[model samples]
Target: MQDIAREAGVSSKTVSRVSNGSDSVRPATRDMVLAVMDRLGYRPNFAARALKRGRFKAIGVAMFDIVATGNLLTLEGITKAASDLDYAVTITMMGKGQQRSLAAVVERMKNLPVDGVIVILEQMLPDVGTFVPPAGMEVLLVTSAQSTTMSTIDEDQYGCSTMVTNYFLDRGHRTVHFVSGPEESLDSHFREQGWIDALARRGVVAPPVIRGDWSADSGFNAGLELAHVKDCTAIYAANDNEAYGVMQGLAAAGKRVPDDVSVIGVDDVLRNLIPRLTLTSVKMNFGAVGRRAFRMVARAIEDPQRSRPTRELIPGVLVERSSVRDLTR
Candidate 1:
């Protein structure tokens, strides 16, 4: 500290102000202090600074994995937004049991200087009332899950599902079958609701939904079952992977897609690479979900007292592909 002060031709107190990012320091003085610190290899100790501010300049993000395509895209948005704001991000991976896994991470963060936390809901099954957030820190829950109080940013799962269902019904199909994600999943549940809503609006009876764990194999199994049914003309799987399975199952049964049955998926995953397999699906802007989550976090961090708890919904666009035929005509 003394060396930097002497090199910058300023007192130690003046050097301290620049190091702490105080706006009161004169521009020339701040520049001189920064230069001296850089030349002297002086690094500000964030831990020490955190103790003074009672908050870390970094935000903690909790998610299951960093590798999933959707998760990775969302992460990119979060990192980009945080970088633009000059904030650091700390990512914690929660595996297996939710109660134990996430609670441990939260405890660890409590020991550090994190200013806020953004909990990504993928693979997160937190126990009821498990999150006891830190007293002076802000918390944001970024998820597709529904709750009245939690701040969330996600797609309109219900609306998009209804759109797909209506697509089939309008085409003169009497019933639409749904290949849903795990029953415990709220995303899957909301999508199912959307399908039912569409059926009700059209005055058609909604058929029973088949279950999948968001896996290709599960979709394949559900497809095999549906293939045997006489009136199963269209299927809306929870995601693209499952839709691929549906295609395989239909092919094995000697049924051609859009001819025997049309398959629609939620995600347009890598659709351009496979020219022959035209998967008509919904294209969700997951990156926008991530961006919105960070924006909410930033707002909460900037003015914790005035920020209101709010939920933001990002809509999805349906991409028409060969997988689904316009049966309305």
Candidate 2:
């Protein structure tokens, strides 16, 4: 700090203000200090400074699987939010490829020097009881299951499936077939229940739900089977990837989309991957969920006594495209 201040012909306090991003400093002085900093290759030692201030000014993020699109998008939101808030983020992949006990996560994070943690659960929490973070550690969870101790954020998954199913029913389809994601995923289960409940409301019995592991291959198999379901006219896939596979399988089986079997999916991400397929789908605001989670955790950090909202749900919107057939007309 002193070296940079001397080099830039400014006081140590001015350097401190510039480093901390305080708006009190004049723009010219801030620029001069930053230029000097660049010339000297001096970087802010956030961790060291955090230790001195009694607050890390940093948050840890734990993702079960960072490879998942939803998790990655949420992380993007979190990093952007943290940057804007002048905080740092450290991530730990708790469950990389297999299931891990909550106790293990607690143990791993016990000594980590962060004020709080944002956990993104890629799979359902193990049958283990409550997940209690280490003492003095605040946790904000992004997951599908309920938690009493940890704050959680989720998309309105139930509402998402219900809306899509109702769309089909409102279009004069007697029932909508379902292609579900992994059985262990609470997200898939919630969506599947939503579809079932919606169909039940109209006194329409839900046919068997085809199972997919969120893989295009699984969706392809589901498509092949549904191709032979004589009266199955509408399908609600667990996600856009599955829908894409279903479409490919249907095409290979001489079945035409919308004309033969109207299909829809969730997550609305396939359009980027397959530009030619005009698939109707639901849009999940994954980044919003991430930003909200950061805010929730940050609140717990800044004001330890403040009571935070236990749960928040970001809603999904239906993105209309060319895949579904509207028979109501």
In model 2, which runs have C-alpha deviations exceeding 4 angstroms? 10-27, 96-99, 127-129
Candidate No. with top lDDT: 2
For residues 154-242, write the lDDT of model 1, one tens digit per residue: 77888889889988888878889999988866678888999998999889888888999888999899888889999789999988888
Q: Would you give me the overall lDDT of model 1?
A: 0.80
Candidate 1: segments with Cα more than 4 A from true spot:
9-14, 22-36, 97-108, 123-134
Model 2 agreement with the true structure over 1-329: per-residue lDDT tens digits: 89999999999999988887779999999999999999999998766767666687888888767888888899999999999898889888874554476666656666787888887866666733466666567887787667777788889888898899999999988889999999978789999999999999999999999999888888899999999999888999999889988988998898999999999989988767775768999999999998888988888888877845497878899999999988877
The alpha-carbon lDDT assigned to residue 248 of candidate 1 equals 87
- In model 1, where is the ten-residue run with the lowest total lDDT? 123-132
Task: Give the deviation of candidate 2 from the true structure as CA RMSD.
Answer: 2.3
* Model 2 C-alpha lDDT versus the unseen true structure: 0.86
TM-score of 1: 0.87
